[model samples]
Target: MKIRAAVLHSIGAERPFQDTRPLVIEELELDPPGDNEVLVQIKAAGLCHSDLSVIDGNRPRPVPMALGHEAAGIVKAVGSGVRDLKEGDHVVAVFVPSCGHCSPCAEGRPALCEPAAKTNNAGTLVSGEHRLHRDDGTPVNHHLGVSAFADHAVVSRDSLVRIDPALPFHHAALFGCAVLTGVGAVINSANIKAGQTVAVIGLGGVGLNSVLGAMVAGASEVIAFDLDDSKLALATELGASHAFNSKDPDCVEKIKALTKGGVDCAIEMAGSEKALEFAYLITRRGGTTVTGGLAHPEKKVAIQQVSLVAEERTLKGSYVGSCVPVRDVARYVSLFQQGKLPVDKLLTHTLTLDQINEGFERLAAGEAVRQVIEFN
Candidate 1:
């Protein structure tokens, strides 16, 4: 089948992306679903920083690849051996496709499925197949096994979680990445107890979700940190007890004073080594610091090694918010439906596929929270 898709031929494109035009919209051929796979007609896809990382060369992947991973769509067809889902089912696409037999999957950590790690790095489906190609017969890699920046995509069933058909596609798209990563970090990773003090460093879509998660988890004090005052204000409006500018030289000092030493759990979602350092600094003795950001592979943070031993500080890296997508997606969506999560506030903009570059420019500029491309 022929599909219109955004294809990135290379990495490290110069910004303004609107001018450099890194992702070329091309007509590509999409193959039929194979065993344990599904053909989906994409309904909505979100522009996230994870996608931006690839464009800016922070997280490198094989190109020319069809980009866009955070999405929701309608299953149009199911492949052989796929019995649980069928046409007309609404679903969200998960970036990592877990093979149930893998060690991580067997241990109830599907986000770290070994086969998924290998296939994602290789830019192929969990089955290690390339389903996209240029008109000239050149293969285009799949982005996180989703390649959802198109009208249609063929993905492994493991990459999809069926959702309630009543949910709006634009809202459902966020559950795939931002909501899962941000909210999951607080609930699943940090496991903040009632009355615990929590600090969130970064106020992007994911960071804001962490703020909301802190509220849902009954944190006594939900502190928000970000360089953008607008984001800080938004975080406060969303239930943060206090907001601070990370760029303020006295930022750490103010937070420490406010919490009488620091927060119980500090979550870093800014995808910067500096942000991770800030999160660590704002964690009180014996507190936890969870980072779900994806910095460049070459980037590293400097921390006092002895702090771990002396203070009993716990620093943990969370991927997909340490989420079990099948379980968390449903749980989070239920929270959304009940108005406890209030994720709808995060949807700030909606664009057509043609406006994708402009949407990305807004994302890079920190002008938008969650922007979704709505398809008809």
Candidate 2:
């Protein structure tokens, strides 16, 4: 079938342009689903930082890959023996899918499922073949199995998270990645108790959601830190009790004073070493710091083992908020439906597949919180 996609033939350095670039939206074709998979007609997709990292050249990716991970859509067709789901189910596509019998999945940690590397990152499904292709029948590798940048995608049934009929497609797409990462950081990884003081460094898509998660978890105080004043204000609206501009000279002092020495939990959503350092330093004795962001591979972290041992502090690195996507995605959708999670406010703008290059420019300009690509 003919489909429009933001195809990347080469890694983007800065931003995508509409002027005859092969790295942005070079229209392509899509194939039908095979065994244990389903064909989805994508309705909406969320722009995520992970996608940006590739374009910025921070995260190197394979060429000729269709870029998009967070998405929600309707089932257009289901492959053989797919009994649990059928056509017309409103669902959000998860980037990771557990084989259920794999070593990691059997151990109850599907987040570490090895199939993720081969299926999503490598753009080949379990059958060792790709779904989408050019009209001339050349392979255009699928990105993350759910290349929602296109009008349709063929993905594993395990990657599909069915949601309630009440949730909006655009908002539900965010739950697929951002909400899961942020809330999972608090509830799953940290297991934060009530009345604890929390500090969140970085107030972008993931960080703001972490602040929201802290509020929902009944934390006594949620201190938000960000370089952008607009994001600081957005953090407050989302649930932060306080906001701090890290660009200011007294940012660290303000954070220290607010916590009466330091906070009980510090979550670093920024992938920078400096932010990770601050997250550790601002934590009191026995406090925990969780770094959930994906940093460049060559980046090194500096730490004083003495301080960690002497203060009895713990540091953690999290992926996708340590989530089991099937369970977590539904919970997030319910929260949105119940009016507890104001996901709509997190949206800054929406663009089309053709305009994705421009959207990246706006993201670099810090003009929007997220720029979603509507795959209608």
Find the candidate with the highest lDDT and give its number: 1
Per-residue lDDT value at 124 in model 1: 94
Stretches of candidate 2 off by over 4 Å are: 16-23
- Candidate 1, residues 95-186, lDDT tens digits: the string is 98889998889999898999999999899998899999877888999999999899999999999999999999999999999999999999
* lDDT, each prediction: 0.94, 0.81
How do the predictions measure up, each by TM-score? Answer: 0.99, 0.95
Show the lowest summed lDDT stretch of 10 residues, model 2.
14-23
Task: Give per-model CA RMSD.
Answer: 0.7, 1.7
List, residue by residue over 1-376, the lDDT tens digit for candidate 2. Answer: 7777787777756443434344466667777788899999998988888877876767777777888889999998998868988888999888787777788888877777887766666777655678888878889877777777888888888888898867878788888888888888987777789999998998778887888788888899999988888998888878788888877777677778878878999999987888998888888889999999778888888988898889999999877888888888878777777778777888889887777877766666666786677765
lDDT of 1: 0.94
Error of 2 at 296 (Å): 1.0
